[model samples]
Target: MNATETFDWAAAGESLAESVTLIAGGARGTGRTAALSLLQLGARVAIVDLDPGRIATVAEDFAEYGTDRVFTAVADCTVREDVQAAAAATAEHFGKLTHCVYSAGAYRAQRPTLDIGADEWDLIVDSNLKGAFLTYQAVIPHLQRAGGGALVSISSLAGRTSSPFLGCHYTAAKAGILGLTRHLAKEFGPSNIRANAVCPGGVVGTRMNDLLSELHREQDLVELAKQTPLGRNVHEPDVVGAILFLLSDLSRFVTGATIDVNGGILTI
Candidate 1:
């Protein structure tokens, strides 16, 4: 109301303290990294993943954050019941849900476009796209109970562009994630909930590396970096940082947006 009024950025960012974040696929890669970052930002975190053993290890590693601040549940993102149970468990454990990140995805070995079978297509789509839908389906009610929250979906640069390395099924599924994320933001904005997607390009430390290893293209990172204007591929922290901004009050006004974490490889 005054021309001399000043905005308090630091005060505005204090919203992360004591908030609760639930991350699907939080046992490894970008998901795990994001969960850890949220802990550092003073948020309690709940990890949902398929492997109980790996979840145990992650929980052990996060012990420094205190057992009371970390929780885990076994869930297959593609399975509706599993996802629902994971969401309910997380909400019950935390008593309030404030943020969510769905980073679970399936990227099988690359095959020729013509050779991709229906089974392969369904597996990838269900895990990447439909899984996002189910996670939102399960988590939104809990998030609403907390008066609104932020949700981020992990997409890929391949989803935004034609991929020379990934299969058609993977590319299509990832692309669908962006569309799905936008719909969530539009539909939930009125409820004070925010949703966005992060599109990472050639991330070096994520499950994408496993795909390269399977294709015997593990050595491509060095060459790929040279093609980027930044002379490097994105690492785990790069994508994690983007997700943190979207999840926190820092991006309170941002929603339905795709934040690219590439090393300047593609700009759109």
Candidate 2:
């Protein structure tokens, strides 16, 4: 049969209908948007965040889906026990886990390399890079149990190139995510698992935006947009779309790939 005759476009739409996804840092920002988008696609969602208040707020926000379809846990991704428990609880609650989106990360006001302290460096690295490592460690077994699964990590355009608005530590941690994702893809390919990363540039209305607003004027963002071929910064949905594609069967053979969602900025 030809490719067109063999392709099931309807199946692609229902790819995630049976998925049970765990979204780290799903309380707000791109992670939160991903959770809502997945829920709309008929997937069961489990969201984990460090803040108890934020977890509760997201739980309420997802209440429309009812308890059977949604789960929420308070977890600090940097802590091994916390991440392990959350992952275990999610699989136990939902009966099986199929996908994970490791979106939990941190950033600080831009600082020079010489001015960055050890404590600050540790905080950023542990929060962004180490947290992703721990989350994958915790979720891999559950993915294995389900026979096969997908993992998507949120890297930054800073990971690919230097960031003008973030510190070196943030950039370093984001870069680490890319390397880690590639390693996971190679190591787990034999087990029918896939791993990928998404690198977004200057997403607006996110926590990063709030931080950048304090550091640079609105004009700076406009100037940055003008440099992009698309003439606009990324939005929450743009990053979420790339993530959803990675999670769905539409990208079944796509692994160890980094999808750039930067509105044509920083193309390689």
Candidate 3:
């Protein structure tokens, strides 16, 4: 794989240019970062988020990338109709949809499974798992009809195994995403739709990473770096690069797979 800094967009445009991609929860964090990267790579993108103001501002900021290429819609991923509307508009805007990236949700307050509240559990699950499921169901038809597309579902390292440090809901939802990806990949492969999950561990600049950022500033970054065989904490761009590969033709033969962008934390 080539470094993103050296990846030539012009060359990619001529060959693997993508017309439309949906970025859920794209107002901030990894979702927004990934959307920006995709835009820079010449993919027409649609930003879907619950926050209308932020969505509008981001769409405007990305105008220079291609006014015709950037789109924004305020939608709650937990709502089916919202996802449907967003999907329909995306299909209409780009003439055809080729990629679907679902990166929506929040991980707040680590609570023990025994102590987790009903509302808290609902909040995380609805946003992470249900939201992804709703968005995928809505956008998949468009991809299937157009012959096929790529899907990159965000999962977390906590999901790979039990974590006393992470909240129960967060890890569970992330694990669920993997199961969803596998099922979708198997069911949709014949239609040419490829689905994969990216499980990230302690992303450096992401919101989740901020939880212990101060304490981990120096000693921890070094320790975390060592935890990963790569000798560096995971970064948004690191995960995004993995994401783009799954979206591009480079992984055409890949599907029903889960890629761990955890800097070699789980080498199994």
Candidate 4:
């Protein structure tokens, strides 16, 4: 390579048509959006979610892409065997696994530190942190077999700072994701696999919003938008863009890093 030679950044950023990506918690929300974006870029995607109903619904919508390009699996991310099976199935169907995203998580009604019970903590931790661990463990070997891959896990703004909208369990689980991502990045870089986390602020019109609405704590969109420096709340697309970048060659050298997708909130 000479100084006169320029990197083909645009081509580098494009997802390969032969690429296969597996996404957990991809039935809806940010995960679904990212899966769609990757598919649009010509990558085959295998989406896994615990809810068979949700998977069916999303599959109905994805069927237009044809079965060769879209695959669906029913698996619980918290269960190691389930995650392992999902990974195996994905690789079997696609013939290779080139990328993975652990985007499955949940946020229930806020509970004070003292008021939160062991059950609540267990549920959140199992879903958010342990789930990510299992997904990472199950997928990395396949990625190594494929020579290399990219991984991005969805975290949250509350993970980085205290938030009025999130509970203790939710914050702790998301924070745990940051540590998990960094460790994987460090341990797997030699294998040519990169790992990163995306921390998104308040994102409306997501299943999280549905949870908030059920808790009677869903705030006015306009009010929440005003609080953001960008003058709008982050949406699924906003987060998906960052996720895609990290999962693409565009961020080949970026690993163990937490990219904020918040609307200029908590710029640390």
- Prediction 2 TM-score vs. true: 0.96
Residue 108, candidate 2: Cα error in Å is 0.5
Better of 2 and 4 by TM-score: 2
Could you say which candidate leads in lDDT? Answer: 2
**Which portions of model 4 show Cα errors greater than 4 Å?**
1-5
Q: Go through the candidates in order and give the C-alpha RMSD of each one to the true structure.
A: 2.0, 1.8, 4.7, 1.8
Clashing pairs for model 3 are none
lDDT (10s digit) by residue, model 3, range 147-186: 8888889887877874434588988899899999999999
Clashing pairs in 4: none
Better of 2 and 3 by lDDT: 2
Error of 1 at 49 (Å): 0.6
TM-score of every candidate: 0.95, 0.96, 0.89, 0.95
Determine which window of 10 residues in candidate 4 has minimal summed lDDT: 1-10
lDDT tens per residue, model 4, 32-146: 8888988898889999999999999989988989999999999999999999999999999989998989989766666788988898889888899999999989999999999
Candidate 3: stretches off by over 4 Å: 1-15, 213-222
Q: Once model 2 is optimally superposed onto the true structure by TM-score, how far is the C-alpha of residue 16 displaced, in angstroms?
A: 0.6
- Give the Å error, residue 221, model 1: 0.8
Candidate 2 lDDT over 1-268, as tens digits, reads: 2545677767876889999999999999999999999999989999999989999999998999998899999999999999999999999999999999999887887789999999999999999999999999999999999989999999999999978887999999999999999999999998879999999998888686687678866677888888989888788999999998999888888999999999887789
Model 1 per-residue lDDT tens digits across residues 16-113: 77678889999998999998888887889999998889799998899888867999888998899998898888888878888889998877776698
Query: Which stretch of 10 consecutive residues in model 1 shows the poorest summed lDDT?
Result: 1-10
lDDT for model 1, please.
Answer: 0.87
